[model samples]
Target chain A: MAPTFTTLGYLTAGLYTASLACYLRKLFAEGKWAGRAATLLLAAGLATHYFALLVRAYSIHSVPYQDLYGSTSLLAWFLVLTYLGLELIHGERAMGAFILPLVLLLLMLDFVATPHAAPAAPARGSVFALHVTSNILAYSAFTLSFVYSVVYLVQDRLLRGRRPIAIMWRLPPLEDLERMARSGVWVGLASLMVGIGFGMVVDRQVTGAMLQFDPKVVISFLILGFYVLYLTVSRSPAWRGARASVLCVVNYFAVVFSYTAVNLFFSRFHRFY
Target chain B: MSVYLLGVNHRTAGVALRERLHFSLEDGVRAGESLRRDGLVDEVVVLSTCNRSEVYSVVAQGAAQPEGGLERYFCSFHSIEPAQLNGCLYHRRDRDAVEHLYRVAAGLDSMLLGEAEILCQVRETYLAAQRAGLTGPILNRLFQAGLEVGKRVRAETRLGAQAMSVASAAMKLAEQIFGALKNNSAAVFGSGAMGAKAAQQLRSRGIGRLWVANRTPEHARELAARVGAQWAPWEKSAELLAQVDIVVTSVAGSEWSLTREALAAAMHARGNRRMFLIDLGVPRNIDPAAAGLYNVFLYGVDDLEEIVEQNRQARESEVPRAEAIVREHVEKFAAWQSGANAVAALADLRRKLRLQREIFTDAHREELAQFPAEERERILRLMDELVEDLLREPSERLMKDREVRERAVLLRDLFGLNAPDSSRRGGE
Candidate 1:
């Protein structure tokens, strides 16, 4: 059963990445053919990804939030969901043309690392479900913010260089990217807020505090602080674009360190494990 | 088929000559009627712009000798000496006419080569001709394709990206001096075309004040009124010259003017402040000898033209890409035209098929008269269904095919349904 899900996850990730790569090439050249193909590929990939997530849920039962493996899969699913939601609202396929591949990459890394389900993982409960879901969704928003920040960096560079209209025309305008980054930070904040709420609830229902004061937790708080500062400064207009992008980039690395790097090496307090 | 275009342009004729022969909107309306009236052309379209005025026409394949009445009509209508105008004029017929209009729209034929305004001017001229009821498919297709080509080039090339025109170059010079043109004052010499254009450019640059000085006071006043600039008489050109920091001159006047003596006094009064001077006059206004004076910098049209040429070359690099788009649109338009022509041919075929069906039904009427009524009705239904089935696909397919469009056009001519031009324009 693990093999079935593992294989589906691999196939879905490969297909999703291929779709994004193909669409990116088309958008840079002949927009019409690429536009049509990108939409179709995204829709198809989302369907397969949805199926794989459901299969993983059933195979493990209890919503697949066990340790590193289940949480990684859940985060990957959240990323895809957040992406599709934005795509539906904006009617812009370019975001998916950049985003889905990143999501797939994270999932693929999780697959290769192949973290086993922890024996100490909790049993089925609404509290655990709510805790993992909120945390992963917040991480998903961070993932998206990270993507736009990188795009903003490149676009801002080109705009300053006095590029011809066509070269940078493919990207969303600088103003649009800034707005998208702000929204991403807001959503990430909402996810962190809910995740923290669920953690307290879990602490109450279980014997003691299930979350340890691990280095990973501290780093996660610092990352959350950096972005909150970013958002607070963003209201002032002085802390936008490059300042915002830099903060988002740092936060993205913090997520990587907290979720994957610390889980793989440092300590045993990884809640997923 | 060869189509030639002939006209006097800004390069070929002086401003006085060009202004004298310039075609006003009303004159074009009248000229459109006269070109057809005098039987000099089988079809004619006139493209008259500020920089150029050309007549594009489709003449007879072979002709009997007749007076060149269109030429005579143009000269008499303008009340100009035929001898004086004839030397400046050029004539291009056949393919040249189409290519010239295309080049004009592409900005290749303008005084400022690769400028964008000519395309819009061509469209206006085409519409004016059309309104006068002087246009046919050949002219209509040519102008429409030319406009498309213009759009294609601008989209695919760096032509518009480069700042090279005299007006744009002057703007660039201002940008260099002021860093930003939020509040600069500039004096423009000679209220002629280029000077007026330069003053307008200065105003657009957000200049705080604009002054116009011309060889003629009324002309300067006219230009100043148009551009909202203060006018100075030509004799006081030196006295008022010290007031502004930037001076742009365009004197397509009869002789070299604005000597070293005139500018030296102005520079002395200006207290050695840096002033940019651009001289666009062909007869050499703001004499090169004036550059020795301090606080005075002067540049000529050739220097400006070189910059524009560089811009032109940059634009030329993008030509292939733009031409590719043009070719696509040209083919697309041709396909559309073919499809349109097919409608007529399909109509004709349908009419013939219906007539044949009627004749076949009539001939069988007698044979059916001897049969029982029920059998006859059944046979007639079969015949009608078969004819409908057979005609439907061929007619629709023929209407859809591109190759058949030309054949359809030929067929229309053969069938005597080549409706008159009036009905065509009125959408018959």
Candidate 2:
């Protein structure tokens, strides 16, 4: 079963890579067929990735978010979902070349790290499962926001520098990139708020306390605060374009620290295999 | 009989020559009717646009070529000397003609690559010929196929996606700055041709609340009415600039029309909302320094040229793909024409066989009068069976065998199976 899941994981990654190639081809060429094929391939990869997650959960006899590898895989899956959702809504696929590689990297990491799965920790109930799932989803949304902000900045630089390249034509319009990033931030902030709410509930039930000063908790709040600040600043026209994009990028780093550094070396209550 | 296309385009002829040879709708109708009536061509459709004038026709096989062909007919109808028009005219016959028509309809052959006006011109030409009672089955099928090819190329390739003109490029830049123009208001300063074109493009893009302002109030009002936009006074540029999300200026002068200070004040009034300014004038209209302000995007004529060049290159790169599509359709049309010819040949052969049987039977009627009616009927049926058996192998070969397919016209001529009906000669 583990071998089968591993094969599925590899197949999913391979499909995503193929989709990325098709998108890149479309960016340079002028054919609708390439864009359509890329989209179909990406959706296929997402299906296989979902199946792999289900199989992993079944094999381990628990939700797949019990450890670092499983949670990262879930995060990668949500990232693809968010991106695909945006693509469908906007009918824009040029950004897929920039975005799908990040998803593939996370999935590859999951594939490599899951083989050395550590011993299972004590069982956590549905509340803890929900909390972890929402938190990972929030992180996924923030990652997408990070990608859009980076694209927005690149487009801004190209337009301002008056050094337009072939890729400039393929990138989404600057306004569209900014709007997509703002939408991602909204998703991220809302999910983070809900996830933290559930986290507080679980902490109260398990430790008979509401606010345990865990390092992960502290960093999660910091990440949430940064995004909230970004949202606030984005409403003002003066802080809207480059300034807002920069702040979004900065918030993503805090997200990285919370998801990785705090999980690996700092947090006690949230430490996992 | 085969289809032929003869014409000159911007590449092959100068504007002076093209204008002299240009055909209006009435002129095309007259030419098509005269050509068909004179038996110079079996069917005709004349496509005339600013960039090209093409005449598509079907002529009889083995017709008198030099004295009464399409070229001489075109020259005589237009009262132009054949020698003078010789250098400008190009001729494509049969499959090549079909391919040329498709390419023209698809905009691949336009002066500006992927421009769409030629398609509409072709459609109108076809309809005009049709209304004049000049089109037959062959020409009809060809024009329909050309139109479909045009639509497919546009949908399947990005050939028609980019803007090739400065006016359109400015609109594209505005779209990049503001995602959807549907909610954005735009103001066009100066009622010159370029500014008017930019306003028209913006209106076509569904920009809301378009305002036209010019140094001359009458020109501004006229331009605004023409494009269905509101006219604003030139002195109200500050208020208009603050209200509109986009501003396009094409006013000509040595001095600046919109300085940075005025724009800054407008920006401040609008709460620093994102604004796109396009200056298409010489010596500059909008101050270039305004680009440095936050949330303000400014582009001049030179900046738009970069986009136009990029778009041109992109369209040029897609030429090969568009050509491939044209080639595929041309081949399909050739195959269909082959099948059509084969069908015509088979029908002719059957008709000839029936005529021969009737003549032989009529000649032997006296001898058959000696026998009973039933016996005569059996004898006639036997003769019919023999004819069917004798022709079966050749009929199947005509449809299937490529080597035999080329002999279809020869067989038709050998059997003297030419239709007495001139209408069928035009097409089915």
Candidate 3:
């Protein structure tokens, strides 16, 4: 018998957990090999995650973003991808200890929340795939922005409090955190705008509707607006550091609301799966 | 022979004593040469820096009262009386000396832990000794191993990662703000000593453009010329603020030299590009409220102190790991030293065996001359192999067993290997 998506998903979670342990070792102890080990494990976890998504897509004969479970899984995959990219670009491994735990949590949630069987109303077609993929990528970028914002705030607090802990020493510098946050916001805002555009196109194609009054659609646009405001205000001298980080955090909540509350409670016509 | 280190460092000696004992490069070379020339030490290297003065030497294994002689020689060389240097000196022999040298090279023994200058000092001292023809095989191996252990400790531990000084703390903080300072411009807000030091540190880290601003334009220009930076007029603070990526303020004053409003206006005009402000003043030259402004990272003396203290603590925590590396290398060097000691015994054994082989060949000279040339060559080859085979076990034992190595000199004496007439005895 072939290996199932659920098993591969569990394996991905295990790999991520191992990677997290290695990253923590690197952060706490002066282990020479721990960093390279952590990077390798994270790369392995990413590969397993991609394989799991592929398995799901093949088993269901549709894209992996056809349901809430698959979309969350894709978001987790993108988060790992973005983190790996940052790690490669920066040559810094300390952030992995903080990031891999979030990846593990999302993967575990995907496992617990996703159904064993495919949903009756599957989100099919290339337009739906493009739309969902873009949205998940946007959410993933937003999630990374949220993480960087939290790091920035924590570093700021540590600096201002005049209490430099060992963990604070291990963290990336405040400026690097801020730059990473800004990059995340830029990518997120662009992906979100493109996702909304594709969502509108899919909406018109499927239901002959121009502007649906769906809560998910409205909240996503609201989240977009929040980030657009963040991008503008963060450029000004007054709102750059703590204020900008707070704005990113606030926008992340809107993302959580759209991903969960709007999909579970309020969305009807916008529910593609 | 054994390696020995006799030294005084910042921890053991005050600045007065250290200054008295400090050796310049020329003094080090002269001292190393004189020590070796006087037959006091087989090999010697003298290392002297701001924080330390050390004599690393190789002496004959059983030399009587070597340490006392070395101590007296060190005192007299520096023209210091023994009474003045009695309590300030430390002596380590053999393994302890090796470990001390490794620790010094690795910066563990530095006043500022993990400072990198000592490694270069170690290299220079070794080179000076070598140029003076003072170092032999043992000192060469010890110094080379010391340098390697230093590099390994730095590469394998976090001891060398953080900044321990105020100037370095500023550079580290600037690095945090701007990942690389290679393309960044900085303006020093005063022509004070601290500002000049900070500017030098920044320039050392590859700051592209540097500006010195001061209340006295002439002083600013003088400092700029001294440090190879540009002098910006004192009244051009706002323009400098708008242009530079870093601003180091060391002006002595009670009032803030850089206010929040002024920085805010500058930030607005600069389109909120990221800027780092290092306030080295007591009352804080940059206003604390300026940190609230966008893209302005303001670190005062207290903030830098926190970072420096934390870094010092971190380096202290890494001492055990770095010491472990040093200890490992010390043990390896000790083993190599032992193996080196066994080399003489092995060579003596080979010489004795060759003497025995020649005696046997001479006794059978008539019988060997009766054989053909090919047969005679084969017999000589057999005798060479037999001698080698006969000594292989003893040679292996000499390298591995301490008891066997101790008995080697007895065996050499029994075989008359050290006698001047031993080779002629075989012919007689």
Every model's TM-score: 0.57, 0.87, 0.81
Better of 1 and 3 by DockQ: 3
Model 1 CAPRI rating: incorrect
Report the lDDT tens digits of candidate 2 across residue range B1-428: 67888899898899998998899989999988887887777789988999888889876554444234777777877789988886788888899999999999889989878888888888888998998889888888899999999988887777877556888877877777777799899999989889889989999999988999988999999999999999998888889988999999898887657888999999988877788888898979877888888788888888889888887887777788889989999987877776666666666677688889999999999998999999999999999999899889888887687757666767667776655441143234
By lDDT: ranked, best first: 2, 3, 1
Looking at every candidate separately, what fraction of the true A–B Cα contacts under 8 Å does it contain?
A: 0.00, 0.56, 0.44
Chain B TM-scores, listed for every candidate in order, come to: 0.54, 0.83, 0.79
lDDT of 3 by residue, B1-428 (tens): 66888999998899999999999999998988888778778789999999999999887644554678888988998898999987889999988999889999999988878988889999988998898898888888899999998888888788977556788988876776567788789999988888989989988899999999999899999999988899998888898898998899999877547889999988888877778889998777877888877567778887788778878787788889999999899878876676665566466568778878899899999999999999999989998998889888988887678767655556545765654322211100
Q: DockQ score for model 1, please?
A: 0.03
Top candidate by DockQ: 2
Worst 10 residues of 3 chain A by lDDT: A114-123
Residue pairs that clash (backbone atoms under 3 angstroms), model 3? A237-B294
lDDT of 3 at B401: 88
**What range of 10 consecutive residues in model 2 chain B has the weakest lDDT sum?**
B419-428
Identify the runs in model 2 with alpha carbons over 4 angstroms from their true place. Answer: A4-48, A88-93, B8-38, B63-90, B127-134, B185-191, B209-244, B257-271, B286-290, B349-383, B412-428
lDDT of each: 0.69, 0.84, 0.82
Per-chain TM-score of chain A in candidate 3 equals 0.93
DockQ values, each candidate: 0.03, 0.45, 0.35
